[model samples]
Target: MSAKQTGTKNRSPMQYSDWPIEQLPGLSQEEQSQLQNCGIKTTVGLVKQGKTLQDKVALAKKLQVNLQYVNKWVALADLARIPSVGTQYCGLLLHSGVASVAQLAQTPTHRLHKQILRLQVATMQRRDLCPAIEQVQQWSQQARIVLSDEC
Candidate 1:
């Protein structure tokens, strides 16, 4: 069975140009500079360079940072490939347990919405700031479309 059949979907390794790494949320200017210095100026570059655990480990070693840092950045970069998700919502989705476009595509919107709402309320103390159910559904739908396009 394929990864998808086993309930673990994987994104295509195709490298496509996307928003610059600086646009990704939670990355500081210094972090952006460090990545740019290593030829990972764009999200797509980061994703391509850190496609696997070994790749992420190599990147972290090269940057002299922890593996988790590269993992988070790569996850953000991968999620940002979704047109609707973009950089603005990548961090949110990651924190909400939707790390990649594949995960988001398989996630049930109702459950994912609840997770996002709880996270927002716990972190920001603002339930109103959570994306609506329809928006969450749209994200999942778009993620599926993206996965299909990749295949």
Candidate 2:
């Protein structure tokens, strides 16, 4: 596909400050304050930063919290910031070898669906798959970023 055609069909790149805070559930007052202190006042900030463990650790240290706490917050923040990627689906994606939003975006639809279904069955979980697939499509269209397979 041509660049112009692709750009016209996808979601525009969103700014961190533009998103609302209410979408991110379970954020403690202290965590919120810490995020704000680090210029991460919105869900988008957390999503963009949380793509890497280094970034999460840095943010956690800044907040004086453990890495696991930051990771959970990052997952919640990513779900809140990105449309169609809910917490449950995010977990499934992780279980299916998708470690980042970029990886989810890069995944082909059929393979992603199969993996998601497999994960659902193995984990004994139920969730609507359409939204997650849609999210992957939307994210792929919007971002050219790809995830490295290596840890």
For each candidate in turn, the TM-score is: 0.86, 0.55
- Indicate the worst ten consecutive residues by lDDT in candidate 2: 1-10
lDDT, residue 136, model 2: 57
Q: Candidate 1 on 1-151: residue-level lDDT in tens?
A: 0111111224554322278777878888888999999998778789889988999999999989999899999999888877667777888999999888899999999999999999999999999999999989988988887778677
Report the C-alpha lDDT of model 2 over 1-151, residue by residue, as the tens digit. 1111111112334421224443345677776777787887666667777768888888778889889878876765553333444433444455577655555567787787777777766666665543466655655443332122111
What lDDT score belongs to each candidate, Candidate 1 first?
Answer: 0.82, 0.56
TM-score (C-alpha, index-matched) for candidate 1: 0.86
Say which candidate scores most in TM-score. Answer: 1
